[model samples]
Target chain A: MSGDERWIHTPPRESATFDKHAIAEIHRAAATGIYDIRGFGAKRKVPHFDDLLFLGASISRYPLEGYRESCGTEVTLGARHAKKPITLRIPITIAGMSFGSLSAPAKEALGRGASIMGTSTTTGDGGMTEEERAASSLLVYQVLPSRYGMDPDQLRRADAIEIVVGQGAKPGGGGMLLGQKISERVARMRTLPPGIDQRSACRHPDWTGPDDLEIKIIELREITDWQKPIYVKVGAARPYYDTALAVKSGADVVVLDGMQGGTAATQDVFIEHVGLPILAAIRPAVQALQDLGMHRKVQLIVSGGVRNGADVAKCLALGADAVSIGTAALIAIGDNAPHLEDEYRKLGTTAGCYDDWHEGRDPAGITTQDPELTRRLDPVAAGRRLANYLSVLTLECQTIARACGKSHVHNLEPEDLVALTIESAAMAQVPLAGTNWIPGKGGPF
Target chain B: MPTVDLATAPVRELNAALHSLQPSTNETVWRVQNPRGQHAIAVGLDAPVTVEIDGSVGYYCAGMNKQATVVVNGSAGQGLAENMMSGRVHVKGDASSAAGATACGGLLVIDGNASARCGISLRGLDIVVKGSVGHMTGFMAQAGNIVVLGDAGDALGDSIYEARLFVRGTVKSLGTDCIEKELREEHRMLLRSLLDAAGLPDVDAAGFRRYGSGRKLYNFHIDNIGAY
Candidate 1:
């Protein structure tokens, strides 16, 4: 064999510390004065739901016949002080993504799919769009730090209101929508100059801390006349204290977004290095809720890296009233279809590996603002695909629940799960596979 | 005229009655007695009605008000007329902090002195303070105008945006990117219109100094990232 060909069969040697990605990042950082800004969640792997395994029923326990047994998946959120609370047929809801980051058609598709599946969809930093509002039967209007398009009339129009303090991908920092995505419509909605990069303030202009937030919640209640539910969303930095504070702020529901959550645009350093993972955050947040005697009274909706039915089932088993999806939802709408492989290659990335959503050149048309690129997506068809995906997830979660002999998905508890790895066992707060031993908790009990 | 006493009616019932009133209904004018520093009075109204508070008001009084007119006879507490959309809110007595904060539209006329952050984030609202305004008046103001007839306290118009600040008296200091601009013909006309709207047509527009943003911090720059 030739010299180059011989090296293929020879054992390859590479340094894990100075890997290609690390080297490339160093080069890129050296070239550009600013930090790397990109879209999507952390690329590095961490303790996730995959590390945990469910021990299905056997002789000692009981299993239900798959088709014969009924497993309920219904969930009700926002029942605290709201005159009208929302109930969904399923426990999976769509996460908040701004109209500026996503195309109008994409937002509409998310709304359509969520509505068809009998769930709710949320608005983002840029405020509620007509297409999204019209498509979604249950729409949650987010009151972000920017307050970009906040209006009293729109406050009355929303089904529910979520006051956003922070997002997961970059907990302490704010959001960034690059100039390429800032179209005239976005500029008009946000009252900023078109084609100019926008940065949202990290804190609310009106209110500062929890004390002000308490008063702010009262003001919101008064403005809406207590007709709609109010939610307080926080990034999972200190889930215990944040959850407790949110409860004290009179939140009807609490939305906890973890580190694995995707951002439209943020510094690359912030993504991989900030906040706790969803798996590690849930127990603390649930403990906070239980401590306050508001465990099930104030529902908790979790988000971050929820991929399929297994993730939903796991999260529900861990005590989440409902789960929300963002990246998975975008994928369901054909964000990086295999058919767009050729186009993705032109952008120096392959399909399913493309994460530069802030560039606004998405081949599948889900994340782009270009007219030609956006036209590639057919909202009706994509929306149908999303609905089909949601249906499959529900079916799979139901299958798992039935196998565990659970009549309802919410009935499946942490006892039904075991960790395959020691790290997973510690993070998930569950017993190790063959042994009923929890690493952090004292003995078997 | 319809009168409502706070001592007898619960806040819920009083607010519910106020919230349910129609603009064309018989109660175009309301007299609220013995407010006694209660929070959230005359809030969330979207009618062309008039609410006259006979005594001192508390926090968030007339918050998110739309189209209706609210007149406070005594000293107003914090966050008076916060996030008001339209119409008028006239504070006859000295006002507390954050007066007309985040108010997008309408005319807020504080006849007495206004405390700190008098017109913070004033978006599309026209504020006319007859007496002096305390420190940090018009902080991060996006749009509209802040017309201070008397002396403006320290760091007036801090981190200002497109909003115009017209002050008639002494200023202690200026905040970052906030500087005085020449009062051209357009500014004179704009100042005159605000004074007229606030029923201060007698106050001369020429005596006021117009302040606005220096056009920095509008966009992100690499060299100045630290400051931004």
Candidate 2:
């Protein structure tokens, strides 16, 4: 037999468990002696919003007029306790991405975009920036375990406060900002020396448990004079218990982030394996609120892998009062634009596959601290693009709501949804398509 | 002096009154009576005023204090003077856990012994405890000075970063990445100043031992896995 024919007859076999990517990761760890760290969320496919489809109106359900009927998308948060509750024209909001993780202009663009869409923008671990505060009409300041640059004046300046209990990307882990991103300004804000790998504390220094957290909440209220709302955010590990505890600890709102939530930098292992998917987390969280007789009283904001209007509509239908976006928003603001593909290739990544946010070499200028890279992104144009994206998402949500025979987006319920796969049916607690079976809810085949 | 009794008025009213004071207000001296160990008493004071609390205060007393002097006649509960900025907080009696936690700028003086985790995550805050401090004191402290005149409990200055810790008495143990260092002239001067600020100028700064980070664990390394 010829050499080619002999090779074809006995082709090499590869193990499924140790695939090319897995082999490459092992080789990298062996060479570097450190686990791979990257940005963005879980890249592995899982049960998500795409598995669920809306059951549009027919003879059984009446549909609203497509063009003439108006579908409301307004949502009010922090109405349970705070004197000043935030009212948003749309249910979608910009999630917390730190100034250090992202550039200053990116933060300003987020604020501007959220303001134009009449939604709120959130601050992250580093601190609140003056530019962000001035740009956004409504801002939510996060009180993280690090307390880095946490100031009382800024607390009072914020429209709302979010107490970050854990993050979805690494639920039990703390934040990690590598040395490359720790510029002079970032170091000054965090009170750390420039060009050092900063590791934030996993647990809060002062309070230990929920009882102590209750007192801490009281202290925050006293600090703000009860004028601003307090939101308790938790990674989706034990959503039912966390939601209950958050409410019991006197939170005005609860933000649940799933495993697919983006982080600036984290271990690849943690990003893929830590918490529950957003689809599986929402039902349990909603049940907890419902059991406590606070389903809508204390608003629920679901996040993690929220892509388009369908994801927003699905989240609302599954009982979330609102949805927050991070990775998607970054993309809308030119994070991985095709025009920068050549630059991305030089960084050993494609445009859509770039996740080295911690390296501070982003071509799109959204996640870098380099002045030259940062100057490439015009805040006004990026902000306008984000606003347009947000507008489209709202319109698409309204169209879906109208088709579901709902006058308001909040009126959409679980009854208007069906799961295409049994795994999604079990996770989302929705009936499987073309069948009356909701896997764990007990229906005959 | 304006006197507000906690028994008569809600804590909210007292905080509101404190918050309403302007920077140049003449009502700079105030007295808080009948605290009854209530939580969040006299918290979030921004003006350059002096607040004197008659009774014991509960959790987070003088938390997030700015440009104010808060004096507690009685003992303080957990997280006293937490995140204080540009001010002074003095506790006449013993302090519970986590005193002056995460305070960026200010001076925290405890006349009596302090419980575990005192000055934890201290950021540029000068803390002086006249008596002994409990275990894990100055744990993960980034930037600050913790001076204990008496003995220190186990694991003193665990995972410390840039924070200087001085103890006059014997330390039970040193935490990971924390090591005793030579008490140089500059450190002695700093200790003396901190002691003077804490109202113990008579104490000898030379008697104290200095401890700080070993410059390890600042950046993650695989060789340091055992310490972690």
- On a 0 to 1 TM-score scale, where does candidate 1 land against the true structure? 0.94
Q: How do the residues B64-125 of candidate 2 rate in per-residue lDDT, one tens digit apiece? A: 99999999999999999998887999999999999999889899999999999998888899
Q: Residue-wise lDDT of candidate 1 within B1-228, one digit each (tens)?
A: 988998776556666788888767888899899899887888888988899998898878888899999999998888888888998999899898889887888999998999998888777789999999999898878788999989999888877778899999888888877899999999999989989988987889899999998867666668766655
Measured with C-alpha atoms, the lDDT of residue B11 in candidate 2 is 97
Q: Which structure among the candidates has the greatest lDDT?
A: 2
Residue pairs in steric clash, candidate 2?
A: none
- List candidate 1 stretches off by more than 4 Å: A1-13, A442-445, B94-97, B113-118, B131-137, B150-159, B170-173
* Candidate 2 Cα outliers beyond 4 Å, as residue runs: A1-14, A442-445
Candidate 1 lDDT over residue span A1-445, tens digit each: 7878966685865779989899998898898877888888877898999999889898987987898889999998878899999898999999999998999899999999999999999999878899998999899999887677767787888989999998888888888788888889988787666876666767776666888788788878887888899999999899989999999989999999989999988888999999988998888888889989999899999999999899999998888898989999999999878988999999999988899999899888877788898888888888888889999889989999998999999988898899999988987789999998878874321
Local error of candidate 1 at residue A104 (angstroms): 1.2
